[model samples]
Target: MDAPSNVVRLPTAAPRKPNNHRFKEQRAAGYEAKQASVFRERYINPRVRAVMGDAETIMGIEQTPALLIASALFALADPDTQQKAMEQLAPGAVVGRKAHIQAIATMRRLRATTIGEQYDFYNAIDELEKRRS
Candidate 1:
């Protein structure tokens, strides 16, 4: 079967993954890389930029002097005064019960079939409020 060796031949390698499988793997890797890039661009980059900007702004003179003075005044205050101030700064109790009450009231005023049929359905969460109160 010997002939003139003038034709160029394609190179071959040992069978590892098939060509189609190799391409699929590469395509999947590319997709993951793109997804990571998009997430960073869409979320991480903006948040980092915002934090850096806020930090820079907070470091400026207007904020710096005020914070320093407040800290000094806070540190020098009497213990009871500090305790009262801290209590004042602390968040008060949530008014969720009142919100539910208002919601139930509003629902009662809505145009239901019997003008008050809405009370039964809307009053369910109100029971939770009653138990809590």
Candidate 2:
């Protein structure tokens, strides 16, 4: 009878702890790249410029349909006229009423202007119109 025994030992290194900061940074970079599509340069960035222009003008206010729904009670009138109306409708709410009235007045004034009559709402977004096609 013959007996043979073979033994093999492999050295194993201690398990290394993951670098939390680097892992987080890599994860953040991946998240940012994924979000890059959420903010397309030609779309969102250009639209941001349009939004800024909208914020400056009366037409900008019209785009906020919700505000109109609430404030529809107010009619377009000059400031003095609005003050007189406010004195009757909602007696102590002077400043707030004035703001609503002023918005209405400005909106009406803008409507009366020649530019208002000629405004092509879609043309503002027409980048192609800038070129001779």
Candidate 3:
């Protein structure tokens, strides 16, 4: 019987890190798609459209949820801008009585979630779903 040789081999060079900038960019695109999904699910009905507008217009800055949310995030960092955006949202009502009140709140929460946070969140969600199944 022949004895087997015991040898340890180590790599001369480290493996290159997989560049995920493209993946991150894709995730950002997914975020945009989520915005569309929100509109489709929340503001889709014809009656809602009557108050909101068509899909494109309602999702537009002039009359879209994004504008309201974006404005709120901007306002969070800048009180003056927030006041202006609030005034624009509810010209007749009080300073904080805009239809975007919820949107602004959501934006505030979203500010804490950057692209990496979102990636983690999605992974967590997927794991939970798998466990549930």
Winner by TM-score: 1
Rank ordering of all candidates by TM-score, starting from the highest: 1, 3, 2
lDDT of each: 0.44, 0.46, 0.49
Candidate 1, number of clashes: 0
- lDDT tens digits, residue span 1-133, model 3: 4335675344764456567676888899988888878465443333323323222222332546876676556746655655565456554343544445544433333444467545544444444445458
Tell me how far the alpha carbon of residue 19 in candidate 3 is from the true structure, in angstroms, after superposition.
25
Clashes of each: 0, 0, 0
Q: How well does model 3 score by local distance difference test?
A: 0.49
Count clashing pairs, candidate 3. Answer: 0
**Candidate 2 lDDT by residue in tens digits, 1-133:** 3334564333674355555675787899888886777555344344334433323344334545765653453344455765555455543334556445545434443332455322433343343334324
Off by over 4 Å in 3: 1-109
TM-score of 3: 0.22
Best by lDDT: 3
